[model samples]
Target chain A: MKKIIAGAAYVVGDAIDTDQIIPAEHLVYSLSDAEERRYYGRYALSGVPQGQQGLPYGDRPFTAPNAFRSEYAIVVGGSNFGCGSSREHAPFALQEAGCAAVVAESYARIFYRNAVDGGFIVPFESIERLLERVRTGDLLEIDTSLGKLSNRTTGEEFLLKPLGDVADILKAGNVFEFARQAGFMPA
Target chain B: MTITEKILARRAGRDRVAPGDNIWVDVDILMTHDVCGPPTIDIFRREFGADAAPWDKEKLVIIPDHYIFTKNHHANRNVELLRAFAAEHDLPYYYDPGTPNYKGVCHMALAEEGFNLPGSLLIGTDSHTCTSGAFGMFSTGVGNTDAALIMGTGKIWLKVPETMRFVFEGSLPPYLMAKDLILQVIGDIGTDGGTYRALEFDGEAVYDLPVHERMTLTNMAIEAGGKNGIIPPDEKTFEYVRERTDRAFEPVYGDPGARCHSVRRYRVEEIEPLVAKPHSPDNRATVSEVAGTRLDRAYVGSCTGGKLEDFVAAANILRGQEVAIDTYIVPATTWIGEQLHSTRVEGDTLYEIFERSGCKLGQASCAACLGGPSDTFGRTHGSEVVISTTNRNFPGRMGSKQASVYLASPYTVAASALSGRITDPREALV
Candidate 1:
C-alpha cells in the first residue's frame, strides 16, 4: 500500500537538477535499486560530508547535517524542479530519501511528467502559499479525492486542481499500476 | 493528406485532424540510450517474464553517448547490461564505444544517418531527441519506463499538440545565427508559454537557413516548452536527405490549409544577438544588456551549438587572433573534431588555427554543460561566470552551483573567449 504522508514541509530553492539529487560521481554505483538514502545528502551539497571518505562531487545543500532533512515528506520548491537531464534515477533518489510529494511554483514539463510517472505526487501550487507552509514546517495534508492541500499547522488550505489525471494516477500508485487500472496492455 | 497528416490520421483512425484536436497517435521511431535503458528494460523484463518479445526490434535504436567511456567498474557494469540487451535483441543499430559505425551523438547522428525524416513521429528516452525535428519530423522525449513500454509494444500514445506558426521574414545578419533567433523566441514566449505546443517555423528566414542552422532553431524549441519545432519540407531539406540517405522518397510539406491554432511572425533582420541569463532558458535579453561581463570559459559544443558551420564561424574570427587567457574550445563530437582538423585555410587547418590562438581543443562529449567531465568553471572559489554556447543556463549547469552561465551563439561564445568578456560577435567581427 502507498503511504500518503501529510504535514511537515521543507523548502528547496529553484532549479533543482539531477546532479543535486544524485551526483554524477555517485552515478557510477548501481542505481537500479533504492537503498540507504542518507548518502544522498553527501551528493546534494557542494562539499563532502564528514563521514563519507571518498566522494568527488562536493558537499551538497540537501544533506542531513544542513537544514531540511527527512522530517518533512512535502517539499515546496521554486520553479523548474528536476529541471536538467531526464534522469529518472533522480526521482528514485528523491523518493527513497523520504519525499512523498513536491509542491513547486512550476516544473519543467519533462521533470513534471517523470515525477508523476515515477509515482511521486508533484502538485503545482502558488509560490506564496508554498513559501508560507515551508517557513513554518507546517503540517499539510493532501486530500487526493478533493484535490486540496490543507496546512494543518497554519489552518490554511488551498485547492490544487491537479494536473491531467495526476490525482487518479497518484491514487493508483505508480504509472504501472495506473496503466493496469486503465486497462492498458502492451501492444 | 501529407505523410504527417496521414500517419497521424491513420493512427487516430481519422482522415485529418484540425488544430487543437487532442488525438493519441501511434509513435513511429522509438530510441533510447544507456542511462535510462537499464531501468526501463528492467520494467519490460519484469512485465514480460522471459517472453518479452513484443515490439519490432528494427525500429528500436539504442545509443550510449553519455559516459561512453565508463569511468569505473560500476559504470562499466551498466554499459555491459545495455550492451547485452542490444546483443540479445540483435538490434541492428546499437552504438557501443567500440563500434566504428558509431556517430558522435544520438540526435546529431540520427539526422545525419537519415533515421529522422519528414513526417515521422520519433520518441526517444532523451529530452534532446527533439533535435531531430530539424528534418521536419515530430520528435519528443519520454522517460525510461515509457521507452521500455514503447520498446515492448512498438508504439506509445501522444496528444497531437496544437501547432503554432512562427512566420519569419528578412535575411539573417552576418553575425546572427539560428541560436540567436531561438533566444529571441524564448525571450518572447518565456519557458512555459508553449507548453505542449508544436512550433512550426515558417517564413523567409526559416526558408533561408541552411539545414544545420534550421536544426539549431528546432533543437532549442524544447527549451521553450515546445513538443516539436518543425519546418515544412523545402528543396534544401530534400537535397540534404538525398545526399545522406540511401533509401529516398519524395519530400513532404505542410498542407496549404494546414491548421495552426496560433500563428506568430518574426522579422529576422530586426533580431539581435540574444542571451538567456543565468537560471532559465527563458530569462532572455539582448546581447547589449549583458555584454562585457568577464567570462572564465566560452564553450562551442552541444547538439545545439556544435556543427560544421559553428566551427567555420569561430575559426574565421580567431584565425589571426590570440585566445583570451582563460578560454577553452571543446568540439561536440569526435567526427567533428576530425573534420575540424581537416578544414584548412591559408595552409593551416582549423585545429592549428585554434591551437595557435592558444585555445585548447578537447575531445567530443558534453563538456562543462552538465558539470564534472572537464575543467568546469569555478574550479576555485573565485571563478564566477561563464559565457557558453550550450543550451539551458540553469544553476550548476556549467560547474559549481554558485557560478552563473550565460548562453549565447557560437560566434558570440568564440568572440567572447577571444575578448575575455561577453562582446557582441558583430562588434568583434572583422
Candidate 2:
C-alpha cells in the first residue's frame, strides 16, 4: 500500500451504486485489454445523475471531457457506496480513472470485497460522513498506514476505520497472492 | 444458529456457526453468466496457469444469458468466449445459445435446470443469485477475482452473516404478489438495512407462495444490501427440489431458539400494492399514491419477474384489454417461453393473451435488464418513464441515465400497462 495518497477529493451522497460507478452498457468492453479498458475509465461514474456527480455543487464531471482519467485521486462518499450490482467493474472503473482510494462511511458488501480482494482500490471507511465535511475538488491527504485523513483545504483531520484482516490481503496485493502466501494454493 | 449458519456449518464440517465467523467451505456449484464469465476465466488461467483445469467442471455452471441477443461485436464476443471456455473445459452445464441447451437469464434458469437444490452452497457471478435461495439453499453473488479463486480451489471463505428476520403475517391478498412483499420490506428497512447480513423471509404469507413466487422474495435480497435471502426448507421446498433434481440433499433448519440481529413483521392484508419510485428500490410508495402517474413503457421480465408465474400474473391483467402504452413481455428462459405457449390462463394461452393484447413479446434472455448494448429489447432511451417488474431502478439500469424507472410487481406493471399510468392492480382485478 502507498504510504500517502494526496489528491483532490470527489465527493458524493449515499447509495452511489455500481450502475452509477460504471453503467452496465459500458461493461461490454474488455477489462483485459489495456486500450479497451480505458472506456471503463472514460465512463467512470458516468451514470450518476448530473446533479449528484460532484458534491456541494451539482453537475461536476469526474473526468474532463473525452478524457480517460479523472484528476481526483481520492473519492469521499457517504454510506452504502457501490450498492447495486456485484460487478467488479465498479472498482476497476475507479482504478482505470486513476482513483487510488475511496473513503466512505459504509459500502455494499460485494463492492467492498471486490475493492479489497481484487486490490483495485483501497476502501477506507471514514469514522463519519465526509461528504458534508469535504467538498468536491478539495485537496486531501491520506496516511494509508495510520488510517487518517487530512483536509488540506479546511485543515480538518479525521480518523478512518481500520482495515482489519483485509489489510493483510491488501498488503499481499490481491486475494490470489494472499491465498498462495497462506498456503491455500500452490504458489 | 439460523439455517444459513447451519448450512455453512455443515459444509465447513462444524457443529455450529455464528455471525462474523469466517470459514472456508466447499462450493457445490459456481455459476457464471456471459458478462462475468470471460473475466473470471481469464483470471483463473492467469492464477492457476493457462493449462490447468478447473477444480470441478461439473460443479461449474456457465449460462450465457446476458447480452445474448445483442448485435454489438463485443457482446457477441463475450458469448463466444464462454462457448470456447466451455468447449475447452468440456463443461457439462454450459447453456450455450443457438443450441437446445440454451437457457436465458442465469437466475431463473438455475432453478429450472435443477441446479438450485436445497442446502447447497451455490455461488454465481450475478447479484440476483440469491434468487436461488427460494429452494432453501445458501446462494449469493461474487465478483470475478473471488469467483476465479473458487474456480481453481473449489472453496470460498465467507463470513457468516447475521440474519434479519422479515415475517409477513396473514394471507396473501388477491391483488398482491411476492414482489410487493419484498418491496415492502425494502421500503421499511432501507437499501442498506440488511447490509452484511442475511435477510430471511418467514411467516404464513411466505410459505403460502409457490416455489416460483418464493424466488421473487429472495431475488431482491441484494436490493436491500443483504448477503443472501433465505427461507427454512419445508415440504413445499422439498417437493420443489425433489421434482427438479433427485440429488440427495439433507436440508437444514434453524433452531427454534435461534436469534436474529433484527426482526420486522407485517400483516399482508394491511400492506397496499407497492411501487418503488425512480432512482432506488427503497424509494417506495403505495400504488394508489403514485396512481395516475404517466408511464411511457411497461416491462415485465428479468429473473425477478420473468418466471412462468410472473407471466401468468401479467397475462391475467392483459387478457381482455388493449394496453394504453408500449409493453414488453420477455420470458426469463426459453423453457418459460415455451411454457407461455403451453400454459393457459382464463381460456387462452399466455402467448395468445399477450400477443392479442398488443404487447411485444421478446426472446428469452436478460434483455435490457442490465442495459447491454444499444439495441437491447425493452431498454429505455431519452427521458422515457417506465414501470418494470425487474429489480433495480438506479439510473441507466435499463439503458438511459435520463430515463426514469419504477419497480413494481408484475400485477402492478400489468395493470399500469392498461392505463398508461401507475394504477393499482386492485382497480383492474376487482
Candidate 3:
C-alpha cells in the first residue's frame, strides 16, 4: 500500500449516492473494453445536481468539460456517502477519473465493499466533517499507514478512523489478491 | 441469534454465530441483470482466467431487464453480451430478451421463477436484492467484484449484522399500503440508521399482507442502508414458495431469546399515506403534509410498487377517472402485465382502467425507474416534478437531474394523478 496519497480534494455534502457518482444512463458501456471504459471517467461525478456539483462554491464539475480524466485526485465528503444503488460503476468511474482515495464521515455498505474489494480507491472515514473543512480544489495528503490526513493548503490535519477489518483487503490491493495470499486462489 | 443470524449460521456450516462475526458463507443463488451482468462476467473471466467455468452454472441466474426498451446501441449490446456468455456457458436460467421465456425486473422475476426459496442465501449484483428476504431468507446486494468471487467459489465472507425488528400492530387501513410503512420507517431512522443491520418485519399487520405485499416492505431495505430485511417464514411464505417451486427446504427462525439490535412496534391504524419528498427516500412526510403539491407526471411501477396487487390498489382509485396530468403504468414483470389484462376493478380490468384514465401504459420492464438511456419510456427530460411509486427518489433517478420526484404508494400516486397534484389517497378512496 502507498504510504502517502497526495492530490487536489473534490468535496461534496451528505448522502452522495451512486446515481450522482455515475448516472445510470452511462452504465451501458462495457467496463472491460478499454476504449469504452474511458467513458466512465468522462462522466464521473456528472450526475450531481447543477447546484451541488463541487461543494462550497457548487457548480464546479469534477471532470474538465468533455475530458476523460479529472483534476481532483482525492475526494472529501460528508456523512452517508455512496448511499444508493449497488452499481460498482460508481467507484469504477471515480477511479477511472483518477481518484486515489475518498475520506467521508461514513459510506453505504455496498459502495465501501466495492471500493476496497475492487481496489478502485482507498475509502477512509474521517472523525470530523472533512467536506466542510476542505475546499474543492485544496491540496490534500493522506497517509494510509497512520490514518492521518493533512490539508496542505490550510496547514491543518485530521484523524481518520482505522481501516480495521478492511485493512487486510486494502493491503493486498483487492479481494482477488487477498484471497490468493490466503490460499483461497492460486497465486 | 435472529432469523438472519440463524440463516447465516446454517449457510456457514456453523451451529451458532453472533453479530459482527466474520464468516465465510456458501450462497445458494446469485442473480445479475443487464446493467451489471457484463461487468461481472468480465471480472469473473479476468480473475478466474478466460476459460474458467463458474463453480455452478444453475445457481447463477441472469435476467436481462434494465435498459431493454432503449434504442441506444450500447445498452442493446449489453443484452447481447449476456446472451453470448449464457450460450457459451449453456446456463439454464438465462432469460433471453425477445423470447417466450423472457422475464422482466429481476427482483420480482426471481420470485416468479422459483429462485427465491426460504432459508437460502441469495446475493445479487443489484441493491434491491434484499427483496428476496421477504421469503424469510438471508439476501443482500454485493458489487461485481464480490459477485465474481461468489461465482468463482460459491462463497463470500460476511460480518453478521445485528437484527432490528419492526412489528406492525393492528390492521392495515384501506388507503395505507406497505409502501407507506417502509417510507415511514426510513423517515424515522434517517437513511443510514439501519447500516450494517438486519431489519425484520413482524406482528399481525405484516403477516396479514399478501406475500407480494411483504416484498414491497423488504425491497427498499437498501435505501435505509440495511444489509437485509426479513419476515419470519409463515404459512403464507410456505404457500408462496411451494406454488412456484418444489425445492425442498427447511424454513429457519430466530430463537425465542435471540439478541437484537432494536425492536420497533407500530399500530397500523395510526399511520396515514406517506411519501418521501424530492431527492431522498428518507426525506419523508405524510401525504396530507405535501398534499396538493403540483406534479408534471405520475408513475406507478418498479420492483417495489409494480406488482399485481399494487396495480389493483391504483386501479381502485383510477376507475372511471381520468388523470389530469401525464401518467404512466409499468408492470414489474411480463406475468404481471398479463395479469393487468385479467385483474378487475368493478367491471374494468386494471389495463382497461389505465387506458380509459388517459395514462400511458408501458411494457413490463424496469423502464425509466432508474433512468436508462435517454429514450427510455417515461424518462423525464427537464425540470419536471414527478410523483412515482418507484423506489429511490435520488437526483436523476428517473432521468434529468433537474426533475424532482416524490416517492409514494400506488394508491397515493393514483389519487394524486387524478387531481394533478400530490393528494392523499383517502381523498379518492373514501
Which prediction has the highest DockQ against the true structure?
Answer: 3
lDDT of candidate 3 over A1-187, digit per residue (tens): 6999999999988999999999999999989899999999999989888788788999999998889999999989998989989999999999999999999999999999999999999999999887779999999999888889999999999999999998999999999998888777778
* lDDT tens per residue, model 2, B36-57: 9998988999899998899999
lDDT of 3 by residue, B161-274 (tens): 999989999999988899999999999998899998999999999999999999999998888999999989899999988899988889998988688988899999999899
lDDT (10s digit) by residue, model 2, range A1-187: 8989899999988899999999898888888888899999899988889998888898998987799999999998999999999999899999999999999999999999999889999999999878899999999999999999999999999999999879988999999988898788898
Judge candidate 3 at residue A64 and give its lDDT.
Answer: 89
Off by over 4 Å in 2: none
Q: Please tell me the TM-score of chain A for candidate 2.
A: 0.98
TM-score for each predicted model, relative to the true structure: 0.89, 0.99, 0.99
Q: What proportion of the true contacts does each candidate reproduce? A: 0.25, 0.75, 0.89
Residue runs of model 3 more than 4 Å from their true location after superposition: none
Judged by DockQ cut-offs, is candidate 2 incorrect, acceptable, medium or high? high
Model 3 is docked with a DockQ of 0.90
